[model samples]
Target chain A: MTTTVIEESFRPGELEVRPDGTGNLLGSRCRSCGAHFFPTREACAGCLSQDLDAVKFSTEGVLYTYSVVRQSTPAFEVPYAIGYVDFPEGVRIMGQIAGLEFDEITIGMPMTLSLEPFGENEEGDPLTGYRFRPAEVTND
Target chain B: MTDVHVVGVGMTRFGKHPDKDATDLGAAALLEAVADAGIDPRIIESAYVGHVFQGMVTGQRILAQVGLAGLPLSNVENACSSGATAIREASLAIRAGENDVVVAVGTEHLTSKFSGALTPDPSDPEAAVGATMPGVYAMRATRYMEDHGMTREQLALIPVKNKANAARNPLAHFRKEITVADVLESRPIADPLNLHDCSPVTDGAAAVIVMSDRAAKKYANGRGVRLAASALRSGSVDVTPTSMTFEPLTWATAQDAYERAGIGPDEVDFAEVHDCFSIAEVLRVEGLGLFEQGSYPWAVERGEADINGRLPINPSGGLIGKGHPLGGTGVAQVVELVRQLRGEAGDRQIEGAKVGLAHCRGGKAVGIEGAACTVQILIR
Candidate 1:
């Protein structure tokens, strides 16, 4: 039996991967102005404060807008869905949409981050990247 | 302080030049501009050249080609606003009394440098997750349609209008007119946006000569047009998530220009905006305060933006109709404004145009609303 060994994360600065295949996108939370930024930041843009903390973003967000990219560069496969999702942290992050048809994706839909197998690394080893999927709903 | 006047403007025909490079196009445009100004090349006190992807010292090569070396030169790159920023820099030199005459040239051999959908820098987080320029604009188009009740057909009319105008422009990239149906039926680049809805990868160059009032008096011979204002702004990081359908950066830039020029949007006789995509035109005109928000699609249907309509827009064919060679696009827009303001636009001319405006916004970062935005106003 062969097991696919996956890298920790495709991009270390933006995402954190766990051994069990669960991870959170990383960003910065400004200590001075309480503003949030994705992929981390050295300082806060709103207040120009250098005091910031690296923080993990929530697992879920709301879809702001989306498109089915029928054309792209060679690095990405064609006809993939991409979108901007608005997090409660006040930052909007862009990511590929999976687990749904392109037509099913719409603005204002609830989404959750899902870590999946991305492209291969230099030695052809598998890498883990993040995608946004429909958020699961539960009722008590 | 000295006032600046644009005494001469020239441009290479905007289209693909498989045989030529950026240096060739830049030199040709610079020489034509110097000749149009009817001044000895020795009087050109300085130069500013704008481009992207072209390697170091492209300006030096261009100046050497024209036998105008040794003049102070600076190469500029601000993404799509590169050429416009070059003009602004030249005007500043004249305004500050550092130089009496300066030339601003913008050239790009984009065909050799790029193909397919342009993306943000590879390091961008968005570009990492499969983001293309067309994909970004298409998302905006989708939201715009939902918010403003804009139909697909209504949006298609923008390319139709611009291409019809381009058909009359002898130097335009796509001189053949296209219909709304053509736009709808074109190859899909992204949902809600097609190949025809986007600007073509083009290679071209344009140059303009700006002089201090003293030099203009000595040589303009009554053909000089006052460059009332040149305004530029970089996008501010969003303090909060804002609507993607609106452009605060464009508005801020134009506000500075209008205030500086003492001209209102209502007085703008015509304009050349950065219509890199069909939807971009709607955002630009409205962002410049020329059209009301959510009102441009209806205005296009009413023929209000046509050449002879109430307020003509993109009479130069725009980036959609004209070719978009990044750095060249901004300078070409000013050249179009100069031509139209001087009643030299020929078949695509707007009659008795006294005020002309040009707007260019380019580049994309992960969180900012836009990268660079510029607004230049000229008065005849």
Candidate 2:
């Protein structure tokens, strides 16, 4: 058997990618209070608590709202569905909506995290980024 | 403490001006305002200038061009509130007994900057995920529709009303009026928001001269409009997630202005708001307590937001029809308010208007309700 090493996430410290290709979004949870935040934080906005713990967020959420972005900066190609998903952790996350036709995505739809090839690093290596897909949409 | 008054106002024709730089535009508006006030340029004891994307000593450059250098000047950048914030700073100087006369100028050479969809600061995680300003407002529009049963056709009427008002404004960017079908069929920038519904990337500048009671009593000649209240506030950190459909930031800022001005929402005769998008006008008015929540769309459909309606909103065409120049936007709104109150807004003047309100909110940062919000109350 050939041993293989897994690549790191496109944005280290925000998204975690394990050797087995399993991953979760990284964030900060206030140790003093129970509030959570996305992409991590130094202090809690809710209570001004400096004590925060890095935690992984749930993979499932419900779409809060969405838009078919037909125009955007060059960093993103046009005509992509972008959305905000409210996770069970009481945090809303922004991400690219994937795994469905433009017309199929609707508000309050169930969503699941799906990692995909986002961009490359300085060394030109592939990086796995995250997107939200409908609950029934599956990827290998 | 002295009451503040707007002694003079001036603006450049709001449209693309590839030949002129921000400094040139600022200087032009400044000179026009000085002449309009019938005062010597040397009498302006201090200045505040607002601009974005115009690099390095923007205010200094404007002062240098207009022969008003060496005076105390502060360049303000509160994102879209930059221009409005400048006006507030100028008023504070008078109220604090620091200066008798001050000039606030807001200019932006946006066409010289980047085009396409404008995003928040690139470092923002929202921008990282491909957040366009139109997309954000479109999402709000979608949610507003879902929550209030607002139809697409009702939202389309906002642009229609604004562009029609813009058609009457010679200094506005869009002099031609548009229709509901035109707004609906225009090229889509984001879902449920088309190019027509969005404010154009415009280049323009505006200037206003604020004076203390002494200066105004000497120079106003009964023409000056009183700056009753100028309030500024930053978005608070949300302890709990707030509704995007309703803006507490706007309400809080407006409440501050109302309290300071000693006027209620019902007393306002007209308004000029930051309508960066059609949905934004709905949000801004409702947030300012001008209309009931989820009621602006239906009110607009009933021809209530028109220039000749019961309560005219954005009679100067707003950002949608008038054009938005980031820093120039807020100042231009004041110019409209003063004009309408003076009965000088030619074709789109709100008749017999005694009180006019202007609201500006700008920028987006994570974990905040809004970046910067300013509310101003002007009375004749």
Candidate 3:
């Protein structure tokens, strides 16, 4: 595990983040059928169209549903709030809600995607992770 | 469409086998199946191989080891249902007149992928932070308990019963029977799901030989189990996204299978359902309409699903006892049903079994249930 900032333009297998530091999610737009995906793909899963355009998504969304996880596993942190957020673009993303008590998180809470620094790996490497933060965060 | 019959089924003992690779175990099962069917390898017209986590061209890798030559080979991966999906495809190909005889094989070497690390989804930022499979099922267990007043002891009974059944199965991964107290005493993987409630990471393979009705009558010994229906359905994304609730996909698939076979759930003598987690067995039993909602645990407690019960469930011990090798589980379930329908399960066999159902549900993707839910009905 190595820690380095990703500055070059790149296409993730599922998602794309713009270089403007705006934390907007990126997806592929099917030029033929206008189908959108959260994690952009090279081909349109709907129309099988190869002609696609990379598009940035709105950073803001509303919580669709959530679960306050009281248990932990190798896959996720324990005692965290995880849920799906519905963006205006008709795409839903599964993510973690930050800066809220497990009991405080509710359905339809306004949230915005944010880039936060995750902790080190086993070899002590820094990692940056993303989460859904309350819309009214003072720092942002 | 032409009918297809499963003439022979074979499965390697399910457990941690550090000595064998995926192909090695796959070929072992294939050999056993071929011998069981008393057919030469050359009789197989094509092969459908199912695997997950194995790299690209897994079918080619496995079949090549068995000296298979140029034939239509397709690799399938549908998460947990990969095995049954492969069987369905192979059966369809034979029915379509593309082949006279087809081999369906599924193998998993999970020991290679058991590294204790977060498998973050590259596409979902939330997945990057952490969301494990156990956590998702735990959420479901929590919700089910809260909604149905189900107890942890009730959930624990699933493994207790399955392990007891596994004790009778030589192919089971864990042959030791456990009590509900033992299940509750085990280490917690997630809230309400102790280590005993979860299926072990296993390495195994299961194969079945499916032949067209014409070929079966000509070559098979008239001992083949008929495949009445094989249906796959996916969950509806439009519904409220909740892991704990029963999804429509399972119901749709079960109904499709039942209708295709012209039989109802009441006609099913026994079933082998996906019990990746103990709570999942509860959901599947309810979702399949075998028992009323919120009555699965009660049914188990009353031995309604026992091997001697009116409607036995998981007579082969399910994923909990038989072990979920992911890709091999679905096919293994079919193998068990075939054995029961043939009256060959011995002590574990359901008495006078005629119609058997095998239901498998895979993991979730994008907040929905598995990408595929498959149900297959077999009749003697």
Candidate 4:
């Protein structure tokens, strides 16, 4: 008999992992000023309104800027492409760029969020995290 | 309100200190400051210390090491702006008539605390996504280059200029001059920012003695330079996506300093703006209104920012060339300012320097543009 390990979301509040392997990043949308914040906040910074609603962010975004990081902390491996992506909800999110060589990534490219294995949980279970890939590559 | 004057300043040689810890460095700097002021240690009414990664009550330990353990003391931590914040707190004590003489000290043993690229607090959302300090600055450099059409060669000039300045500073971490080609060919830490562009992890400390106007008249012995203004501001959460190349927090803090000092940016004779990364200097001076937007790179090529030029910037070599002991960086900037104003800077002195400016901005949160920023104007 073969046993399969179902992956859990690395951070349940930030990412939701559906049983079908499709999920969305979570954030807070200010009901008063219509502003969005990543990882959620109790009150809106724009208008200081506490009437915030948890919402899932759209996966597609435009690459604003990026860098090939050669040196980093111990947890992260070397030479990863990291970037800030501008979403339609007027928020800029930072993530690792996946599915492309370091030199091939460019500014203004459309990117889509891709859920992948992040690391092992404390109990040694597989955990899922997100990275941004080229939108066209996501289709492939 | 009483005017505040920096009667004396002291700083440790900025470099790796494998044998000494933060407490040792802090005590040495504090003693030097007291001696430089030529005052009895008993005259010091209070003290404030700034540091990061050093454990609690570090200020008390420094005071105890110096045998002044009983006075009221507070430890300050504002990331890289920690030392600058301590100075501001000391100035406030003088201005409020709460103390006649106060000492501000900033010390850090960064080499022992961290190595390689520094990151934000582990809990930050960006840090969770693998954001390192070098990576963040490199991304900004990329955006700045695209927005202004700045060449990579032009960017290389910044480290070259700073290292040459550092060669003249005996206390700097790197005392050898480097060429532009050296900068271009150095090991890459992050794309567009070579190893030369990043400030080294260093161990050091700096101290300043601020006195009330009355105290300066009695003990300053004609060596005091007026601290015209010391302004500090924390970054506000962005209401909207802002430009990555510009720094609004720097501008706001500088505006406060300029207003308090009744001085404009044009009157600045020299400056010691934080150059934690090469691109940081361009952002700082422009944000302070000392240079035009997208104009610093060309100005640097023309020698407009040299020690002998119209507006000398980072004459103490800045963080890139001198060293960056996160807590000590801000206080060291003011020490350079005081030395220049008093005409005591032997080899790297700006001629007839009357007014000097020092700026420090540090820390990175998830949504904030910057953590804390400080601008100080000193006049002779």
Candidate 5:
């Protein structure tokens, strides 16, 4: 089986690519107001502070809400699950749910970010993007 | 500021219009409004037109079709609130003493332009990630059910009620009452939102003639609904993640309208709100303070939101039953308000109705609660 060599990120700013095949969602943290945002921001929405720093968000989050999308535009396939996961940074990010059955998904479930094959580039190279999966519970 | 009144309102039958274009529909609605006002078409000194998907000079095309090509005109676009924004701009013009009589028209030939689920702008990150309008609302419906204990059966009643109201509205797209079973059995567009739960892609137009007190006195012929307030607001960027079950954008816009009208939610006799989806009606009415927070689904089940209920909601059948032509949706809401307030609604008339409200919230952008929202209150 052939493997991907040259990989790229669909959204370079929102989704960071790592040489090690693992990356985190990027967001902005306001230095003055202590607020965080998704997809990053130039200024703090709360205090309008311009002192912002781009940071990687935690991979784990809680599923706040979700839906099974049956119809969509031509870009994406149909019958995929989508939801918003609330990260510790106080930002809720929406993405397609992966690695979970439709019936197995529920609100308030613990989810961990997982990078997987997403789409192609202008040169038709496969790219890695992020999705959420159920965090494995440990038997303590 | 001078008191503004909707001297007349008109709307074309909302459904598939293969023969008519946006300009044709707009001119038809405009001429109807002018005739309804019992005034010469030349009395309209200025105009505002709202549309989306239709290209530039859409307003100019409508003016040319209506034979008022030389009049000063402006075209407005604010997502689904485009038409309502046009009305708000016209009201502001009178309040600013810019014009005594102005016409606002909203028209869209949506069936020709789009058929499937609408999306945010292509540049939006959400669009790139496969977000459909139905999918977003379905997620909200799921969250609302999870947060408020709203059952699936109860949510089905919203479409049922709206379609029943549509049966009486001659100009509505749907005239047959549907059942909760119909909603459950319909093809699923998104989980928790079936075909019936979503508004249709329609092609239609609606127009309203707003006049200052002086023009109203001459053209009203004892039929004028006071445009008490026309308030608009854009969605605030979310500094922190907020509840999907509530609409801060809708509340803020309605608050501006309430303060300007010097009235509270309790005084509103009836309302026509944007019900693009079944869940949207719940969010809008509750957000507008027509009902308590997290309580609209149960309210729909209790017959409290019926045509003859304690507080009538969507007496014109809303976007669901009446059909949603995007740009036309907002103006049609005002047309319904004017008809109900004037006791001109033939079969679905809300008798003795004096105060009516129209709410429109449209467009969805990433990181915001909503895109643009407008609230207009009318008193007769």
Candidate 6:
């Protein structure tokens, strides 16, 4: 058997963008309380459970709500859309909306997550970022 | 526990002040409050100063300007609720016999901070990646719309009403009247949320003097309002999913204050709630048990929360119409309520106003709707 390893500088809990361009978020689940946490938690917030399991969350969800950013912030590109998505697992996550015109992102639109490069750090290192894109529409 | 009474309240005109430093504004408000109470500076036993980002020893620096040397000083940072928390701490200290007369002041000079970095760091996994305060609040507005079938026109009415009220308040930062169409057509910051829906970044300060009941009587002008209750609560690290719905900390804090004051939400004639965004005012009204779920907007639409409504809200024009100076907002809310209770709010006063409530919540850390919430009730 041959083991393959990819060499890359990544932050802890840094999400890997799948070859398909979908961004799957990795998180930790508390064994004692069945609580899910994003960006992973060392210990369970509920019941102080130390037993935790690593899990990959679905990269797709319905657009809960969103806002068009007419203003720019250092952490984000100007004229972007940001919103919360309601995952199938009943969890809500916040992320940037990518690959869409400012007027196109609407509430209740289906979206798929994608991991991309965030801006660099003070030291000029490329930082990986997570954002969501509109999913393909299907005929009912 | 001993009773605490409010002796004096002071506030700078809330607005953009590029010329003033936080310490300068804070010290000015303190001096005014102490003078209003006719208390000597040497008599203040302790002080609590609330500020968001004034670097190390911020509280000490502000008090030192007011001749407060070696007095017990604590800096509080609870986001928008910072001022309320400082006041609560000082009142508790007095009740516990730790001090006789204490001053609680809040100040913010945001013009000095970088406006481009207003959002929390998104590199951290728990950060609100794409959401600013307006974005989170827009979600609630959407939910409210879905649950009640409210229209955008109804939501726009909130800002219009608040701005109208603010026009009469000389101390309000934005005193210009705005119409529904003005709000509807304003630049959109978030979907369904226009720039008018949000409060502007402001620079100002507010202060209050709280003394033990005996001291208060000696200093008050025979009409000073009583500090009926003050309560502070922090978010729980663990809780059931429903706990997130109510934001447990705010609920608990309001409950504690209402119980201690022996008053329910219905008894409140008017309230100054955290309205950093228009939706926040709706949420706070519901969260504080003033109205049923999904009914806040209806209440607003029907003029139930207007200056002349059944239960006026933000009569001094809230953060949305006034200005949110971060640390100064919470204390300013209390000051507005005090003026109303004392029948001194002038044009923005609620007729026959007696019991008044003020709430402030802030801190946008991960997994928490708010890092802290403070509630206070006043009576004449």
- State in Å the error of residue B21, model 6: 1.0
Chain A superposition TM-score per model: 0.91, 0.89, 0.75, 0.91, 0.91, 0.74
Query: Chain B alone: TM-score in each candidate?
Result: 0.99, 0.99, 0.96, 0.99, 0.99, 0.95
In candidate 6, what are the lDDT values of residues B253-358, reduced to their tens digit?
Answer: 8999999999998898889888877878877888899888678778887899889899998888888888888999988998898888888889987999889999
For residues B184-275, could you state the per-residue lDDT of candidate 5 as single tens digits? 99999989999999999999999999999988888898899999999999998888899999999999999999999999999998999999
List ranges where model 5 is wrong by over 4 Å.
A1-6, A137-140
In model 5, how large is the Cα lDDT of residue B203? 90
DockQ, structure candidate 2 = 0.63
Q: Please give the distance, in angstroms, between residue B325's alpha carbon in candidate 2 and its true position after superposition.
A: 0.7
Q: On a 0 to 1 TM-score scale, where does candidate 6 land against the true structure? A: 0.92
* lDDT at B244, model 1: 92
Q: Candidate 3 at residue B264, lDDT?
A: 93
DockQ for each model? 0.79, 0.63, 0.17, 0.75, 0.79, 0.41
In candidate 3, stretches whose alpha carbon ends up further than 4 angstroms from where it belongs are: A1-93, A97-116, A119-140, B116-126, B239-243
lDDT of 5 by residue, A1-140 (tens): 11332367778888887876778889899999899988778788899999999899999999999999998887788889989999998989888888778988899999888777788888888887777888775456
> True contacts preserved, each candidate?
0.77, 0.61, 0.12, 0.76, 0.75, 0.43
- lDDT, model 3, position A25: 67
Q: In candidate 1, which residue ranges exceed 4 Å CA deviation?
A: A1-6, A137-140
On residues B1-380, what C-alpha lDDT tens digit does candidate 2 reach at each position? 79999999999999999999999999999998898889989999999999878887899999999898999999999989999999999999999999999999999999989697899998787887788999999998988999999998899998899899999999999999888899989999999999998999999999999999999999988989999999999997665556789999999999999999999999999999999999999999999999999999989988888888889999988999999999899999999998898889998878899999999999988767789999999998
